[model samples]
Target chain A: MVDEHADPTVGELSEGAILRSILDRLGASNALVGPGDDAAVIAAADGRVVATVDTLVHGPDFRLAWTSAYDLGYKAAAVNLADVAAMGATPTALLVALAMPDSTRLSFVTGIADGLRAACRELAPGCRVEGGDLTVSDTLTVAVTALGALAGRTPVLRSGARPGDVVAVAGELGRAARGLRVLFERFTDAAHLPVPVDESVLAPAERDDLAAQLRPAPPVALGPVACDEGATAMMDVSDGLLLDASRMAAASGVCIALETAALGDDPRSALTGGEDHALLATFPHDRPLPAGFRRIGRVRAQGPDPVLVDGARYEGRAGWDPYRDWDARTG
Target chain B: MVDEHADPTVGELSEGAILRSILDRLGASNALVGPGDDAAVIAAADGRVVATVDTLVHGPDFRLAWTSAYDLGYKAAAVNLADVAAMGATPTALLVALAMPDSTRLSFVTGIADGLRAACRELAPGCRVEGGDLTVSDTLTVAVTALGALAGRTPVLRSGARPGDVVAVAGELGRAARGLRVLFERFTDAAHLPVPVDESVLAPAERDDLAAQLRPAPPVALGPVACDEGATAMMDVSDGLLLDASRMAAASGVCIALETAALGDDPRSALTGGEDHALLATFPHDRPLPAGFRRIGRVRAQGPDPVLVDGARYEGRAGWDPYRDWDARTG
Candidate 1:
């Protein structure tokens, strides 16, 4: 059993001490090099590796009141894993760096770890929490870096889309935005019993959409399968389908014409909402999509600024812009 | 040329706008999947890749007054690359995430990019900045993730150290600690013009040390050489030697004994001072030392912890502990 000392907040322990204790508990077998070194090393069996990083600050990305520590950990891991999956890679390991107030609870820290472990089990089975650094700060912030493997297949790139390629999407969209909206409304209605939205009123579509936002199930396996099946261009719809599609078009020197009518009801949500974590790709027009995907749009030979819906420009708010509407609404 | 507008701080720009502007300027050819997508994809020629990440926070890690925006960028890249080097990999790509106050200068942002480019040129040539995110916060923080290639060699890990392995180190020591000392001293001595120590001494060492702390010179090429020469256990020295060595011992399930005399003129600096960005490793005692390395210790079959100076326990401070001391002093 480990020795028990007076439990102090993160502020009470020095950075080195905190890291050392955590490393000791994590054990050294899994780590090639644990914390306290310049860096930690992990076994990346296949030579190639996929890497992604994301940072979440207090107030902006998450609220301690709204989400549990476990949720924060799970979300952080999900975001990074989504990046690796977007590259058609299988996540293998993770490194976390956290900064929080000294007064924060140890249970909170453990909850974060539990969340990370839970996400790793579900999304990135091969990945492990190899190491991390903990330091005391005024606010709580978490930064996670995830490493993945390409498994010898060529990584699907966004610039591979050619004119006339069929654009398809895998996974649900618009759920997370709806979830945020619901949560916000709840907070605003704190003066009286919060008017709970009817669960049935949230259509199956809406439920799926909310699920997509809260815990985005990144299409980790589809990337390599798409590459193997001859996908020309591929990307994950993170900012919004329209915005990401435009980026692919700009990169490939082609135009992407997304068809809103093809979006199977709730096209507005598909076009403007973000945080779906769906895999979007362009393939040869003649080929059928692999399982678990649906046709959404097509690559065009000629268009201006990557149009949507009958080659018309999408001028309305089509995705999230954190500095603008999201911030205004949240604040 | 792009359209000009009033330069706004990162907080003023939406996440999408910042990403779009950077992606547009990065050019089409180099970008596989530009920002706006769930993840940016880059083509990896070799089947192998290397990855590393580091996070830097304001006040605890660096003060804006002493370190510039450029310095933060350089430092962030340097530390992550050092990790890649420790893994016996050659850095090829980088992803960055920046969090800063709304009032941060555009010039400072550009300066940070310039610093990143400068460090990349020095350590990993031909590497491109692939992707990142920008957000507003009360303090400035930078997180950098770097990817590298192994060139067909197995990565060197720290768990391979064995009982009879010779311990060796490559790179300078104590420079960063001394630099910290100089920084604090300069602040203290600002009132007394032309005081005790030579101003020239104060500036040169201070500059060198600050550079060491800010823009570390990581030995990227050395890890592969050590791996090729049969390094049993390997790691980069980020913390003080004693602490790091202790970690190595704990990881390898073996004790390490240092030869105080062999550590060259400043043994204390080698033992307790850190941020030297040096590579430390253990090899079979019979093997000849490689170029640019000095044998400093040996792995022992039995010992209570990492020992120094001929079986004598090091009762002095082990290494840098953030919570214990903020003022410059030997850990």
Candidate 2:
């Protein structure tokens, strides 16, 4: 359906020319000193900036056959933007550092730029790709640094959770993890290599899960709302609800008790699955939960365990760790 | 002199353990929310933050055989710091995203952390490693994002150069490139593969060049000084004077005239070589130049060429572009 030979590899073009192609797709810059300059100057009107960096490597993070260039870019931006939002801040700009093989197509590069723009426009409206770096590497890597503004609010830290706080969550929980299962089961070959996904063969919910895994729409806007409504603590449930909640509990010196009945149909996946950028926040028991957040748990005094699900310590595996989990493979 | 076997590989350790090791070496937190949080909150006292990103890929950016882990970290931080300084801002923090092979040693990771700390202390005081991300990749890559404060001054842009402006520079011109030549000439085998650098065999000047290439110390503090002293235009000369100046010339819609006589010792290398990281800035003709800055040339109206070396267009290779230069040899 497409002419592969028509697309030029990045190595065949000058760096300036490739840069021009990427810049063309990124739209207008809102920063004071945008893309062309050595650095971008972003307004931090509240005198404080929230910053975070995250990287997506080819083999461990995603497979080229399964992930389009656009999804890669969108996921990279979305992940880092969620980190900033978890700090109760609004993302203003992203600085992406991209390194790829010389054999990478120029069209693929532009596709990434378009996806970055789309993610910024949808997930965090005012955010834009203000700056970036490019280099040649054997492995494809996208390292994105997101910057945010707290807008005169005290950052809601994970250590702020008190014993009487009510735990709540916003955004999808188990969808991304379920999507990972679908990929491994349906789209992987007998040799354990990923193949191109066939969406027509999958049901609607499966398709939703797959989309959630590839192109997540985290509740970035709700982060600020939780802050405005007096959230006691907050964090992004990235490495699974159990693992991240345990981290928050350990930091707060409290015990977290989750109600399994509150979680959707797939409770185990919701508890153990990763790559879900759900905002987990704690609010005062007396106050009503924020508009987008739904109560899922409660914070108790520090006990033997950091997290207790349905009044019992969860005995299953907690979450994914790249060092312990990823098996190096390329398709 | 070092016990390579004593240091455990990162793959054998948990991701949390590796992160703890890196965090241990990064020193105290100057940020509102430092490492260990979902994100770091940094102070932007002047209401604006100057941000920049630069990456060093293993093969094209450096040879692992020639560069130590310490040097790699230092160079990565130094390059990004120079970008922020070129914008006439004081660097405040750095967010590093490091991706490496699974077999990389834990000591090597700590070595990089030490190098990053050392560079921040020596080159840009008050700046610290506020946040970072670590991932596994086939290629070793360091992507650093530096953030700075302008302190209410207008950011100096490359497009502000006008006719009759005095051109000046602050740091080394061709030392880093000369270092690369030294490594290629003396430290490579007949197969063009790099070997470990033997500092004992090199002369003082050669060693200085090597150090300049590996651990550059750009005049970061002078950026704000140049701004305070009324610099009209400025940029970092990372890709050699001719090419970067040509870029400035194009951006400013003027011609940059350089005096080869102003270049010390090796004028040709100074003219064509790259990776200098010197601050190339312009000031009004009336006032005396800043303390660290030395006059080199003057700006002229738009001409046939963007850059004129000694009043004539240079005919040799101007600089290195990874797209056209790299040969994809890992060794």
Candidate 3:
């Protein structure tokens, strides 16, 4: 039962009251026109803006039992920021659309707002929530749209990779999936009451894995650097490396060859793991590799298989396909 | 009860397959980079972009039984378009984030996509769905983010109204709310099986009201016209004229005095009905009202009441507050 002295539920508060709480946490606006207007006016200095949207829905994306409000907000912002960065742009602003059950606590809402600000400050500095919409729903959902400025740099597309390009990646790979495994192994017990995760007992490495799962910090700063370094093709590694690489290969009408030896201890996990938000990019073999990126593979002419591991076709699970995997569950 | 051949559920298909079906219906993209990229690159002429987001959740916003997928999509896009237009900008692109239950039919998904495209074609030409994300959820949600181009014009703000300014409005003021009433009176019944509305027997005016509720076509084009005509302050009338006008009044530190005689047949409904998305604007007293707008009231120095009707303070409900009104229900 809710304590009478405790903070009231969002159902008991006005939308304006909740909005004021969030705005207070978001700090100041850097756009031409910020919140409180019909719409926000943002400066697109180069006359062009890069935009992308991503949504995190309850159950399918995360379980409240395993995630905190702050982590949820952080993950939501980080995921969308990764998308904008994948386009070789620096995020200028974020528009968040939050829908939750009215029973959600006012403190929980503020926690999320604080998390949104914290993510922007830590991951994509200078990029903050510019405007958003809040509504009540049966299921909790966070939909974020990120806008970025290319600053006159030509966008790096997945279809731009050519033969003889060196394949590389920036940011961690497989760690998030490992974190997911830890959650499934240690935290997904039916016996435990629903509560925020306690990672104190886990080993240091396992704690790191959990952090990767809950709050991913992708290499956002390296996106523009990769573009400036003449990267030919790039994309966010959301679904496994094997699956996403094949997409880039298919888009470019080329083939990507991976070196399992380079994949830190668990090659299989690195190849098939998902949700790392790593930047997968292809650069010219002649130029020096960018500072944050590590060479892991190479680009070749079109082949029967879009991706090959150490010369042979890598088989088994290609990666996470939301529809297919989700179907497997409910079926 | 399930038809073997009626359409496969979204759970039975891959995300890519569902995406392909929707993409087939969404025509083409006019942006620099469109769907298929991590992010879309849209041209924001004159170095400024207008951005906004709005969400329609299943229960609070629309019911599948009462609203067709097409109408839901159209209304979703239209509402966001009005927000952008209220800033005196021409919408250039939309990014839609849709989350639905796994049991949702492919046909329904495609219908919503068709509706989204139809709204763009009819309401704001040259604007299209450039990118979006689709996911699974227990509750259906549609979140749309619209981007617009200012074209070197200064945006009309709600805080710019002066005491001598004349208040004017473009488009229907209370039609959508009337349609909502019709829905509650006839549609929200315990016996109704959720079905697309059949308004075959309604009178023509009632039909128009229903259309306004289901698929609102707000005066989007008039926003730029008002801007060019030197509207001192402006906003969209989503939450009724009284509430929205008071918002404009409070932001400008003025009092809005509305005349009932100017509000057509049902002045009460016109004053308090919501969801019309009408453009409420103020212009200098010396300038002639724009062609599409009708004079509604005048602005005055700040008074005890932010809004005055016929020189007296409004006594009844000021307007719809999602929080307060919603609490009255669940309580």
Candidate 4:
């Protein structure tokens, strides 16, 4: 449906013509100098820039039969923007490098551009695609580097947690993981081949959860707000709550204590689900938590373990790891 | 041989452990906030940053049989740094995202880090591998995002050329293309495999030329010098002299006239050989060309064609394009 135009394969089109189409769809940008030049010039403002990068590979990251090109592009943009937001900066510009097999359809590439534009408009307005390279490969891959301006504010790092600080989150959890589970079940039931799943048979909440898994909509706007509210430490929960909490604890030399009741009683799901891309932060106990942030835990003095549940250590596989000898064919 | 300490494939190593090894080898950095954080913070001096990104795929870009992991990493860094330099900015920091198959060796990853560090030391001191992401993929791919600081100078765009400007280049041409030719011949003679070629059979210059193809030592030092001398326009000679020149002309709305004699007698090689990564610039006709720069041509008023040879139109292939269907297996 996205390829209503004369959909020619990339090999049939000149690279110059492909670039022209992509630039045309990118619309306008707020960068000082956007995509047509050798390199893009972006306002660094405050003499510093916050930068992060993420890569999505074809088979390992996404299955072509499972997700549309638009979803892949949107997910790529969301992941990188979430990283910049985690650094407590205003996301501004991005550089994208795409590698695809020559046999790939031109429509797929254009769909990706549209998805990037859509994400920019929905989350970080004024952020533009700065510059990038297109090259031929055996598989499809997209890598994005996001840049942000801090506006002279001190960056909220993962190493600033202290005793008595309140642990909070600004977005949802468990939905993406649950959605991934459903997708795996459906795909596996269809004999390892992609078949259309009847979404109408699923409940409305399940549909929303599946959408979250397929295309995460992170709360990027809350990053700077948390920074303004004097957040002590912050990070994005890409690897799930418990693993990220442990990382924060190790960095700050503290222990994090989580309350199961505050996390909706589904402690395991809330703590171990990955890919939610929610902002996790710790604030001083006296400071009021920002709006939309739910207080779920407390930072404590260094203990035997990094994370605790109701003052007791809870040991479990923290989150989904891409390199832990997982089933290659299914993942 | 590269991994004498503990030889293990990437499948045997965890992502966290691999990251630790990489960060350990990376040593020191110039970033304000370095690799341990969610995102790196770089000083964007003069309130702006010049950014560019490039991707290198395994089969289409380089054959593993012909080049080492070290050379692959070095070339990737060189290509991106050249883009930043082409903008007339001092290259500062880089973000690398590598996706490799599970069968890849741990030593290959470390070797790439060494190559990246070596390039930073040789070309742009004070530049650092600020941060990176390592993920599993079906193929070996390296994507890099390079950032540079303008340091209070205006960027020299490819669109700034004027009619009365002198065209010049600060680096060699034909060598990379010629080297590529030799490599392909040797590779073909070896029965489409990566049998090591006997370098002693060739002349010393030929050996050096081939080395240039494998590991290009681009003249990054001349970029800022050209800017300081008031260059009207500038770009990198990546895709070849004639093709890139035509691009510059098209962008600036001028005609570039090349003197065939100024280049070597084999005008075709000098004109159409790509991947030289040389600094090409245009200066006012009355101004002295920068030191080490050789005058090769002149900018002319807008004409019927974007580029000309000795004031005449020469029709031929501009340069090596990756997308063109050449030798499917060898390329």
Q: Using TM-score, give the best candidate's number.
A: 2
lDDT of each: 0.71, 0.92, 0.91, 0.86
Segments of candidate 4 deviating more than 4 angstroms: A1-5, B1-5, B189-191, B325-327
- Candidate 2 yields a Cα-based lDDT of 0.92
lDDT score, residue A196, model 3? 57
lDDT tens string, model 4, A197-312? 56887789878877887788999989999999999999999888998899999999999998888887467878998888999999999989999799999999998999998888
The CA lDDT at B328 in model 3 is: 22
Docking class of 3: high
DockQ of 2: 0.89
lDDT of 3 at A279: 97
Q: Is the docking of candidate 1 incorrect, acceptable, medium or high quality?
A: acceptable
TM-score for all predictions? 0.84, 0.98, 0.97, 0.97
**What lDDT is reached at residue B277 by model 1?**
75
True contacts kept of each: 0.28, 0.90, 0.86, 0.78
TM-score-superior candidate, 1 or 2:
2
Compared with the true structure, what per-residue lDDT tens digits does model 1 show for residues B216-263? 887767877887898988888888888788878887888889888887
- Across B1-331, the per-residue lDDT of candidate 3 in tens digits comes to 6474678888888888999999999997899998998999999979989999999998788888789899999999999999999999999999999999888999899999999999999999999999999998889999999999989999999999999899999999889889987887676546543445669867899899999999999899999999999999999999999999999999999999999999999898899998989999999999999999999999999999999999999999877877667532521
Q: On residues B1-331, what C-alpha lDDT tens digit does candidate 4 reach at each position? A: 4554476877777888888878877878799898978899999979999999988888777778777888888888988888888889988999999999887888889888888888888988888799888888887999989999889889999999999899999888888888877777765554565555578777887787788888888888788889999999999999899989999999999999999999976678889998899988999999889897999999999999999999899887888666774345665
After superposing candidate 2 on the true structure, give the runs of residues whose Cα lies further than 4 Å from its correct spot.
A1-6, A329-331, B1-6, B329-331
> How much is B319 displaced in model 3, in angstroms?
1.5
